[model samples]
Structure formats: C-alpha cells, structure tokens
Target: MIIERKQYKLLEKIIFEKLVIQAPFKIPNPMPDEACFLYMLEGQINYKTENQNVSVPQNESVLLKCGNYFSQIKNDKSATLHQIIIVHFHPKILKSIYSSDLPEIFKKPSFIDDKIDLSHINNDFLIQKYIENLMFYFDNPTLVNDDILILKFKEIILLLCQTKNASTIQQILSQLFSPTSFTFKEIIENNLYSNFSLVEFANLANLSLSSFKREFKKNYSDTPANYIRNKKLEKSTELLALSEERITDIAFDCGFKNLANFSHLFNAKYNCSPSLYRLNLKDK
Candidate 1:
C-alpha cells in the first residue's frame, strides 16, 4: 500500500503529521512554541542535542521539549519502513485544559536546573495501543474530524501525565513553557562536568559552531578545547590531591574517556601523570 503524507488540524493549537522514513536522514529544526510528541511506529530514531543522544526504538515514543535541536532517523536493517506520528501543540492549550484541573503532581515547575534534558518514556502498552489506533485513522482520514482528533490528543496527554515518567515529562514541559536564563559563563561552568562534545555544547547554547567559538573566546579569552581541557585537568588535580580514588576513576569523573588520554593531558598540564601528581600530594 502506498502511504501518503497525511496531516490534520486537530485544533487551532494542535496539528498531527504522519510521515514514513526509508533511508537515513538528518535535519535541524528550531523549536517552535509547540512541543512535539513523536511515536515511532516502525523504525529507529536518534535524537541528538549538543550534550546527549537518545535512541527511540520501534514501538516506543519520545517527547521533545520546544527547543532547537537535530533529529536523525534510520530504518532498521531488516525492516522495510519507519513510520512516525508526531503531535505538535502549543503549551497554552495544555494550560487551558489542565492547569486548574490537574493535581499538584502534574503541575509544571517554576524553574528547572541546568542539565541534560533528553529522556524518553519507558515501554507504555497503552500509548502503544493509542498509536496503533492513530495509524488506523491516518489510513482512514474520513474517520477523523476536529472533535475526534481533539479527544485523541487529550487522551494522550492525560495518559502521559499519569505515567511513571510524569515528573520528567512535567519538567520538560516546564522548560518548554517557562525557560530560565543563563549567561555564557554559567552555561559553560555548569556543563563542564558533562561529557558533551564541542558540537553538543554549541547546540545547547543555541549557537552555530563558529558563533559559539567566537563567543567562548570573548568570554574566556581561550579556545574551547584549550579552556575546557585545562579546566578538566584542573578539576582532576583537585580530585587527585583531595581523594584516595584511583587515577582511572578520577579521569572518568573529570570527563576523560580513557586513562591514556587523561594521563597525557595531565602530564601536559602539570608536568606529571595523574598517579605521579597524587603521589606528590601524598609526599607533601
């Protein structure tokens, strides 16, 4: 059966878009005022941020906050197609529907701390059934109208709020609707302990790679690689001097992926390997 792209204006604030993916593809999309709930009916998708990457497998779902980010989708090796159903809606609609009706448990947070926000809802059989039914409607558009679609969207939202992952989902919604502000330095300092690559950092800052580099230089007076490496090694030295932990563990805690790389950078920064540096601290 030939699958045609189908869309429905469920409400003034909600839209449903159904698409299929056969080959791998990547796209960058700025976050609209509306958050998107993506259901992977039949393929795998890798959602990448500046700091994290999450894979949504077939029959699973992931909710994306309203933020600029990138998405890559690839069909399974044995599968013939990857199907996706995305519900996009403004935060206002949720507020109008549930703000007073929802319990305190479902309320959005006033503020969220700076951290990696990429997460997915675990296996939900009910949501799976909902998406299965949604695919039927996509196939038979005549069965769907504004009222039916609105009910479907509301059902999904209420079901989501009742899931075990409700707190996380609420946090994401809070961030989407009421985002906090952070200066460049604050963003860098808070994320130093994270293992995000440079590209990821840029994405998190909502800056293009070159622009991020320019701004980072203006703020820190150093290149990103050099500044971050120095800071990581500096933190490693503090850990070495203050704790009795093994050097390899310390290396990982400082965001170094391998002992050798940590050792090399440590020697370059302090003129001694991490072990030797700790040994010196002990001698003192």
Candidate 2:
C-alpha cells in the first residue's frame, strides 16, 4: 500500500493535503514541524503517538499538536482504504494569523495537547462543507487567492471555536502561538511508557540522535536505552505486584511489545520472570 497525497501549499507555512493510505502498511512516525487539524474522510487507521494509541474512524477529526508520532493502517485482509484531509500550519503561519486584525476570540491562546479529539463535536456537516470549499480551491489552484486562503483558515478556526469543544479548539490556537521546548526529562516522562523508538524520541525532543544521546547521558547519568529499559521493567514489576492485570497487559502498558521479550528483560533485571515475580509478591 502506498501513501498518497494531493498537497496544496497555500502559504509558506500553510498546506492542505488529501492523504490516501492503502491498508496493510504503516507510516513510520512522520512528525511534522507544525500543528495539524486532521479530518478523517474514509476508513479507520490506528494512530500511535508517544502518549496515545487511538482508532480514528471516518468523518471524525483530531487536532494534533506539533510533535513526534507514527500511524498504522492494517487491512486484516479487508478491502477498506483509509483517507484523511490534513491542514498543517507551521508556527509562523499561526503567528501570522494570530497577529492579524481579528476579534478578541482569535486573540485567545491556543493550547497544545498531545491529541485533541474533535469527534464529539456535532458540527461535522458544517466542517465537511468547509473542507469541500477548500477542495474547490484545491482543485482550481489557479483561482486560489492568499487573502481568501487566510480567511478560510480563520473561518475553520472560528467554526471550531463555536463547537462544544471550544475550549480545546482555543487551546489549540493558544498553544500554536506558544510552543514550549520540552526538556530531556519532560520528553522522557511523556514518552517512557509509549512504544516509540529511540529515533522517534530524538525527534520528539527536537534533537539529533547524537545530541539526544549526549543530553540523555548528561541528565540521567545512563544511556537512553538502558534507562528506558530499566524504567519500563520497574514499572512492570510495580504493576505486577500491585495490580491483578495480566502479564501481557502489563508488558504492553510498560512499553514492551511482546510478553516473551518482557519476561526475558524482566528476568534479566530482577532475577525472576514476570509471572514468577508476581507469584513471589503474592506469596509474601
């Protein structure tokens, strides 16, 4: 399956893309440098981030804060195709929009969350119409006007602001204008429990791989891989001792992908397998 997109670069910092992804494939964390409003148009896909793993169904929408993430679309041998419309706005574009002569509502700060689910908003029809209008411009690029595109962007923001999820929409705008740089610790805390790779973590921290390693050593006094592995194993042990959750669930929740791997790592770290460790705690 291929990842296809018809992208329209309306401004230096604004882009409209219609993405079509065939099933049975995974798009390894294509982290954008800007925040995005993602509207699901067709089938479902499993969207995974450092902080979330969600199934975004068709017609639902999500506002993704600018950060590291990856997505997977599996067919399960079915014939369903996944499609999405994305409005990606760079920080500069956000700044331009925020600085314009708009009302006080537009001046409100856009908050940044790892993920903001917009499916609960009952304004899907209205938002879909706006997308259709944008498509019209996309289809007729010759007729595209910068002033009109800016207005369209503002219109969508205003429409979202009027929805029930107005607070989140406002935060999205507010956060866009004020992107906080995550510290090494903050990044680690946010993603330690996720199934993200070292490279993905580097991207999340906005650092090169070597720089991330250097910073990790400086802050944690341990290699990134070792620190994360130990932390996950510790978490797994705590969960095993404290909760009745299955070992497999504990493994997954602790960021380990498989039970065998988790058990091996756990045994190596604690001198006992996960199930045996749980039994030991129970016996005590």
Say which candidate scores most in TM-score. Answer: 2
Model 1 spans > 4 angstroms off: 1-3, 11-14, 74-80, 95-106, 179-284
lDDT of each: 0.71, 0.69
Q: How close is candidate 1 to the true structure, as a TM-score?
A: 0.56
Give model 2 RMSD, 1 decimal: 5.8
Model 2: weakest 10-residue lDDT segment is: 114-123
User: In model 1, how large is the Cα lDDT of residue 174?
Assistant: 63
Model 1: number of backbone collisions: 1
Candidate 1: 10-residue stretch with minimal lDDT: 23-32
Counted clashes in each candidate structure = 1, 8
RMSD of each: 9.6, 5.8
Per-residue CA lDDT of model 2 for 1-284, tens digit only, reads 55676766654544677778766444433333456677778877656654566676777777665544444554454356788777776767766666656444435454444454222343377888888787787678788777877788778777777677777666554554555566668778867767778888888778899999999999999999999999999888789988997777678667776779898898888898888888988889
Q: Of the candidates shown, which would achieve the greatest lDDT relative to the real structure?
A: 1
